[model samples]
Target: MISGVLISTLKAQQASVLQLRNWRTLNLRRTVVSPRIAHLRHRHLRQKSIPVAANIISEFRKANVRCTPSGEKIFKQAYAKAPANTFSCSWELYSPLWTTIRGEDTPDSLCYRNLNVSSARQWRSRQAYDICISFKVYKVWEALYTNSNIFRQLIDDQEKDCRDFSRCCMALQPLWLWLKLVVKEGLVERGDVDQLPEPSMLRDVVIGSGDPPDAVDLGLVNPAMCH
Candidate 1:
């Protein structure tokens, strides 16, 4: 009778252990697997909602700015690594501006000399008006290379707070001036546009209110070329 009792006890213990194991497996599926699956599904939906622009990619190709398959892959990888809230700038404004960089391959001396003369001419035209601040924005070219970190930092800074028109333009002017300085100083090279922000992104910072700053009516663009 003792042997029979021992056998029954052993059976009961094995059953209990097996039951506990099953419960644990089910619990893990519920707590871990399900949440992971849901997260993946959410990511997929977000990606689907934000489609990459085919036309912009095509324009890059047209400009002889084609990325290698690996490079394209890395670009996508970078995008994936960025936070979901990261801002993407517009290609329409960016493309036209980049295309205007005609002399990126020219020597620094020649570029600087031309810009100097141009600045002088503009300055003379505006000598009658009191200059509030010397605001300048330079064209971004494929040749003027900056690292991705600069663009990332700029976007991060812009997103930290909402900007109105004057605030937005003020933010952009400094960055644009810096980009020109970077190129003129030969800190970057031809086709080194790794850090170039999209024009749309620039626009967002410069005119966040979807309108021009208060000075626009004062002939900010022409302003006697200064006004």
Candidate 2:
């Protein structure tokens, strides 16, 4: 087991790298006020704030900080802040720095960029799974109408409450799904799971332990043992 001091230190480090911010300063969400469906294209590329949260949540999962619910909450909050039309309304065309949860640069954040862990689960999109099973609104913004400017304001101006930022991220469910498959294929790793101490079973015990809670690729075993 990791010592208490180490855990604290690790958490502190993660906190410094994994943060949410008030992105409500500049006006990213600009439109002519028309109901044009074509206007809302691949919204993620257009807005920096929502993706900023998306990147943060991906980092959290890499860190393994109960990100499923956390991601869901942040999505809901962000959705509340966005305008009533398509979610692509916000645009932080200038900001390049992505902040951490504790309000610092995210250079130290974990990188499970590939999504390789089969044992892990990701937050389902509001459109996919019922929120009843999902965690409570990370904050009130979770339930906000997608068309509200509040959703856009939170990302361009200031950091909405942690939960509020989470709300906006709800729209990025597909991104998480892609990560899951990529991680499972050994393309990426979650920081939390990777950072976890080796299981007691792996220490001195032989292979062939009972089934792991999550699927493990049997091929990873030593070739000599498989025969």
Candidate 3:
């Protein structure tokens, strides 16, 4: 009985020491997780670029510029005048104004893929959206694209695609700015975009339903989509 008691006392002492060590180490683990935290932050940053692009597009919506609807008509018009074998003016002038590009490019500087029928149609659709945003933003500020310095540098490349274009816009401005601007301009109203619903008429009006009511409605995103 005496031996067992001594052994038990020793074990208890060891266990107490272990527990103390664990307690002390917990703080170190929490403090030293910088790498993991940084990785998580990078992942979050990568995830955020799309919404930022979308928001930048939305910002131009309020500027109320001349926007042509994306459909056969606008596509045909832009296509009809597309520079054949590297001619310029009129249509190409419209291209820079609406493409949000720094300047026009020659065949070598700006190369466009000859997408198949469906892909070409899709490309036109995307270009229409770009045009709408660009026109509005341009009208709001004649230097709208020039403000996006990255875009200014990209015009010379001519090989950039939709992904590159969208990514460039995302890098220009944080998406949160778009949400805030709509609220400020009274275009979006309140609650639907910010924190929570309040006990008032505006609450019911803005936040019709759902958590984080202000969340951007992305509508049927494809895994391969860059938009």
Which structure among the candidates has the greatest TM-score? 1
TM agreement with the true structure for every prediction = 0.30, 0.18, 0.23
Candidate 1 wrong stretches, greater than 4 Å: 1-12, 15-138, 141-162, 165-174, 189-227
The per-residue C-alpha lDDT of model 3 at residue 58 equals: 43
Better structure of 1 and 3 per TM-score: 1
Q: How much does candidate 3 score in TM-score?
A: 0.23
Best by lDDT: 1
| Model 2 regions lying over 4 Å from their true place | 1-39, 42-44, 47-59, 62-219
Worst 10 residues of 3 by lDDT: 103-112
Residue pairs clashing in model 3 are 109-158, 110-158, 192-214, 193-214
Task: After the best TM-score superposition of candidate 2, give how far the Cα of residue 119 lies from its true spot, in angstroms.
Answer: 32
Cα shift from native, residue 116, model 1 (Å): 12
lDDT of 1 by residue, 101-155 (tens): 3323423321423445245434333432223122212224221123233254453
For candidate 3, the C-alpha RMSD (Å) to the true structure equals 20.4
Q: What's the C-alpha lDDT at position 43 in model 3? A: 94
- Between candidates 1 and 2, the one scoring higher on lDDT is 1
Model 1, residue pairs in steric clash: 89-201, 90-200, 143-191, 222-225, 223-226, 223-227
Q: What is the lDDT of candidate 3?
A: 0.35
